[model samples]
Target: MLSVRAYVPADEARWDAVVAQSRNGTFLHRRAYMDYHSHRYVDASLMVEDDGEPVAVLPANREGDSVASHAGLTYGGLVASRGLRAEATLEAFERIGEHYRGEGIRRFVYKPVPHVFHAAAAEEDLYALHRLGASLVRRDLSSVLSPRERPAMNTMRRRAIARARAAGVAMRVGTDMAPFHALLASVLERHGAVPTHSTAELTLLRSHFPGQIVLHEAHRGDELLAGVVVYDFGHTVHTQYLAASAAGRACGALSLLLAELVGGVYAQRPHFSFGISTEDEGRVLNPGLVAQKESFGARAVVHDRYEWVL
Candidate 1:
């Protein structure tokens, strides 16, 4: 029999240990990351144990009579070690469904990690979600580049990088998040919005996952021209935020930064994600944004979201 226990602060050590061994789990799923924003969500996270051994964990929170696989993070679902077989996944999800139903939770939103980010096989939960009749509710396309098979940068982008390098625009790992967040906010504000994570939140996360989350910026002496905040997920590194100033665009500083990142610093990683270029629950495509990412030789991979009536 499988049983679930509500997660609490004391469970951090145990929970993180499981996540560390989870095939599909990224640093985002760690207790340190989830608990950092605990005040924002009604924590209903769970630890699933079968025959007295932890089999899986869910970084979830309550929403009405429904439970979400963590709305606070980009992706979330059952996190389990590669040791679990498909049959075990199905049984485990059945237990999870039953537990939620018993607690009057009406539905569950499952966001499985995309295959591109996986360091090992981790799609068993997808099969179980199908068995539970989960419906696909959203799918965002992320642009990605594989360093070893990297396509030649188009002539324009190549020239931009060459020109910037020729003029001495430099890209380097950075410690400051304030200026970059302001740059990010300014960029998004032009389109009528703000950064998803405030500067404070970003600083807090960096403190928790120091090595996992890093900042890279393009500069000319004291001026901050462009920057990107990257999340390192072992085999793949994702660009969480990308922004450039008008000055940056004129001098092609951002193009230089990304070129160095995708071809230099992160060149050996299996994938370099350019993040999503979709909005409106993934129903609308931003052609211009997609083209910008594609200009760097990136291709698309679907990051899907699913829903179920518990």
Candidate 2:
């Protein structure tokens, strides 16, 4: 028999274990990462079981009559154990809907794990969502590069990297985040926006998962020129945040920083994601933002959102 239940403190070990063995799970799904901003959301996460053995976990939160797979993380959905088959996954989704309905939730907002983050083929949830008549409400496109079959970086970008090198830009992995966060804030200010995570929150998260979350900085002598906050998810390394100063942009400091990461640091990783370029729930595309990423030989990988009415 299969069943679903709300997650609790005692379920932490089981939840972490399920994520650790899940084909599409990243460290972001772990409780430690998900609960960092627990105060901001009413936690309604779920765990599904087959004969009392944990099979899947949904990192989610409840707001009003809707339960979102996650509002805190980039992407999430039914994170299934490696051995879970299509049939079992469908059943898991059924139980999840039933459980939420019992709690008076009228809708489910699901943001599925993008394919680029998968360790192996894991599209069971996508199939399950379709069967349940979930509508694709949103689609954000991310740029991804695969080491095994990467295309050549555009000549303009190549020249930019050369320019950065000639400017004596230096790249290094750093533990301090304050300097980088400051630069990131300044860059985002130009667009009338701010970072998703507060500096203090990012600092705490880095402390919680030091090796997995890293800050790559580019400097010119004593000046911080550019930086990219990276989230290392085993086979994939994602740029969670990125920014550059005016001088950095002129000198292509960010370009050189990416070259160092793509060519030297994480060359063996299966995927390197440049996050998203869409805004307003995917209705708007930032052409310039995406073009810059594509110049580095990255291609489209979509992050999708679905809505299911119970």
Candidate 3:
């Protein structure tokens, strides 16, 4: 029999272990990452067991009458061990439904781990959601590059990188996040927005997963021109945040940094994600932003949202 229960503080180690061993889980799903901004949500994460052995975990949180896959994450979903199969996944979902219904939650929001992030094919929960009559509510388009079969970098991107190199733009993998965060804040300020995480939060996160969370920067004659923070998931590396200064844009510092990442540093990785180019729950696509990503030989992959009334 399959069973589900609310995750407690005592379950931290076990929860992290399951994520480390799961086919679809990344370091992002670990409690260490999830709890960094705990004050923002009421965690409703679940642990699933089969005959008393932990089999799966769902990273989620409660919001009024509904429960959603944790909002702080890029993608949250069922992270299952290698041994889990389709039938058991369905049972797990059924048990999850029962547990939440008992808690007075009237709706469930889900976002399955994107296929590129999976260490193996782990879409049993998607099938389970379909069986449960879930509605496909949103789809955000992200650009991803497959290193092994990627297209050549477009001419415009190449020229930009060349310009940066000619301007003596240097790429550094470093620990000082403040400079980059400052540049990021300035870029977002023009759009009347802000970064999702503060420098302190990022520093804390880096402390938790030192090797997985990395900062790469572009500099020219002591000036911090551009930077990107990447979350490395072994098989894949995702650009969690990227920003460029005005000088950086003029000299193509951002392009240079990305080129080094996709072609020099992380070229051996299976995938490199440039993140989403859509907004307003996926209704709007930022054409210029996506075009820039595509210039680096990246193509479309989707992050989806699904909902079902309980």
Error of 2 at 227 (Å): 0.5
- How much is 108 displaced in model 3, in angstroms? 0.2
lDDT of all predictions, in order shown?
0.88, 0.92, 0.93
**265-304: candidate 3 lDDT, tens digit per residue:** 8888999999999999999999999999999999999999
Best by TM-score: 3
Q: Worst ten-residue run, lDDT, model 1?
A: 147-156
- Which runs in model 3 stand beyond 4 Å of their true positions? none
Q: Local error of candidate 3 at 132, Å? A: 0.7
Ranking by lDDT: 3, 2, 1
CA lDDT, candidate 1, residue 199: 88
What TM-score should be assigned to candidate 3?
A: 0.98
Query: Residue-wise lDDT of candidate 1 within 124-194, one digit each (tens)?
Result: 99999998899999999889889767667888899889878887899888897999999999999999998
Q: Give the candidate number with the greatest lDDT.
A: 3
Candidate 3 lDDT trough over 10 residues, lowest sum:
145-154
